[model samples]
Target: MSRFKRGAHVDSRAGFRQEKEDCPVPYGLLKAARKSGQLKSIRAVLMYLGSVPHSVWRLNIDTPQEAQQNLSFGAADLTKLLLSSNKLQSLSEDVKLLPSLVVLDIHDNQLSSLPDSIRDLEQLQKLILSHNKLTQLPSGLWRLTNLRCLHLQQNLIEQIPQDSGQLVHLDDLDLSNNHLMDIPESLANLKNLVALNLSCNKLKSLPPAISEMKNLRMLDCSRNQIESIPPVLAQMESLEQLYLRHNKLRFLPELHCCKTLKELHCGNNQIEVLEADHLKHLSALSFLALRDNKVKNLPEEITLLQGLEHLDLTNNDISSLPCGLGTLPKLKSLALEGNPLRTIRRDLLTKGTGELLKYLRSRIQEEPKTAMTLPSQAKINVHAIKTLKTLDYSEMNKTHQDKSMTTNRGCCRKATKMEEILLGESFLSFDLCKYRMLAFIKIKRGLFRFP
Candidate 1:
């Protein structure tokens, strides 16, 4: 006899065996097999048992009553559970039964707190609770050593537990849009953290220990009350992108050690100076944004950033720009709008970035070369005049020639008329007059002239 015939009973209402009904076997086929005695082998019994694990479950977008009732199901084999977008205000303590659970997504819910039993899930790796009314996290949350990603953004959370750094395996964390006043120094213990977002918070300052996160790659602290950045931030060699927009910083921190930094955003601040030391070591920088600041001038050293691609200095007190700005090779986007720039025309600036960069480059090529050439030519002319004075010449003619050369005009007519009486010897007077005529010619053309 088949296993279904020996141990399973047919439900008369559904006209099929209870066990085979839920299986994929057809009711008529099972009836025919029973009638012919064909279901007699162990291989026939294994065909009805499917090979799919019942470990994943989703109770999203369901009514609160329905979600609560589903929780009664056994949780021994559960590995992933998604309860997002529901009306759940509380999680049952029975969640601790799922010791094997690894992923729990409860975002977009009305959860204001989590059950203390949550820490019992030692295998939990990801916990998402964003867009909720959480004002604080449970202390037991710090015990989850295997947790890799935690997103608690868009919450009313005012403080983070100092022991949060215990989750050393955390690779991504987002705490933006909260009322956080400060961060815990212990966060530096998350040595494996890769990305961190703390934007739109009330943070007044950052912990100096933040530099301990040597493996961090991206950090966003924008829209906060931060007054300054810790100098040790330059020690984070893996840092690639940093955002400090809409803060109260008055000066840019020196980043001489951040050789791998690629992008920096410090817009909407009170920064007034951009000194050489501030930009000297960011050789790999590609984007720099300083819009809406009090900066008045750009240092000549800014030209040292050969890899810079975009420069934003909009709405500043800058009145002039260094001509070297036009020589950067990789510059593609240059924003200078809303500045008090006096040298460049407003109409030309309105034409766009391309025209502005082109104009700056043209200034470099148009620098007057004549200023460098004039001094050398002047020295040669002076030497030639000194040699001419050593030649034979009468005192009367020589004095007339010196006065004419000093006045930069030909007094030859006066000299020739004076020679009629001053030097009556015809041959001597003729040669002297001829030499004076040639000197006048040379002075007229500016080849050799006396002051």
Candidate 2:
């Protein structure tokens, strides 16, 4: 303790503050090297760590020991390593030191190559190396059998090794935005893959062998030069979503066998017609996107899509729609714009999906007078409802009051959400909104009917 009074200034005292050298915290690699206690190896490791950027040098150490004791980052304990957005030019072979690593993300870097030693990471489950400049992947990369998810998008890779099928456990593989004009036949061996993205590539066609991946759920081949799809693709039992936009396809393959398919996007193609056989088996389909195509009309069987939600037919050549489509229980968004639709007026088309469905339903409620307009060769054999003297709309609603009353607030919200997806369209007209309010009010008044 100083003998000076408490008010004395430090500047007045000689050598007021003692200086100390700044020592940075010991990161993982350095600490582990120090723990080994081999002077020569320690010197070599320290020099390597000193040269490495701060990102990977930390080794993502999660636990610590006493400050005086060197910490050994156990390979088993370092299960995850994230070195993204670090501008890393190269990781070299040192990454193999972390054999127990389960997740390694090095995206958005300048890596021109990867070390073949990466195959040593047998326990790695997810490896993200997207947004790099690598034109090729090391042969050893395919041998990582335990890998589950591998993302190599936005790379210059023109080819993939045939051995890529060795990754049996992989479920998600995104190789989009690459220069791959063709993929290897062995890619079909990834049977466990659930989601495969090959979008924005130079692929002129997809291999029919890919249909062998029975477990694939979502397959995106959009923005390619593909002019056709393999008929066998419809045989995939687990396929749910298929995207083939921005292609040169003139027609769709019959997917009658793919019952599990939910969404099929084939926008910006040259499909001039949609066959009923192609739409019939897609019973589970919800969103059917056929925008910017040459489709002249929709098949009457389109009404078979009972679960259908959003139907995007923008910029097509369609002139009419099936009245039965309005009868679909889940039918909601109906996008119809930029088409040469002569059957529907401009003002009515601009009114949006809800009003269009309502109009179609009203047309359905009318008596069918088409028999008088059709030619004798196209004779239709049908009994008119008026000729049968069936009950009218009000009569049916009165009998089915229970069903009408069951239309709860949840159903109304579903309608609102469905209308929200009608891209770039005007909202419901005032009369339409008023009619909905009246229907709900009718429920409260104990006279509920279907809206």
Q: Which prediction has the highest TM-score against the true structure? A: 2
Model 1's TM-score against the true structure: 0.65
Give the Å shift of residue 14 in candidate 2.
Answer: 24
Structural similarity to truth (TM-score) of each candidate: 0.65, 0.71
Expressed as tens digits, the lDDT of each residue in 1-451 for candidate 2 is: 9997688555755565433222233455544533442111223322333323332334434334543367434332456666666556788687776676788887887889999999989989999999999999999899899999999999999999889989989999999999999989899999999999999999999889999999999999999999989898888999999999999999987786788999999999999998877886788999999999999988766776878999999999888887867777787788888887776778988787788888788887684432122111121222221222111122122322322212231112223311111101111111224123222211122333357
Q: What are the lDDT scores of the predictions, listed in order? A: 0.71, 0.71
Q: Write the per-residue lDDT of candidate 1 for residues 322-418, one digit (tens) a residue.
A: 8879878899999988889999988988887788888988986666221111110011122223213222222223322333233234323333322
TM-score of 2: 0.71
The candidate 1 region of ten consecutive residues with least summed lDDT is 370-379
Clashing pairs in 1: none
Stretches > 4 Å off in candidate 1: 1-76, 368-451
User: Per model, how many backbone clashes are there?
Assistant: 0, 0
Judge candidate 2 against the unseen true structure and give its global Cα lDDT, from 0 to 1: 0.71
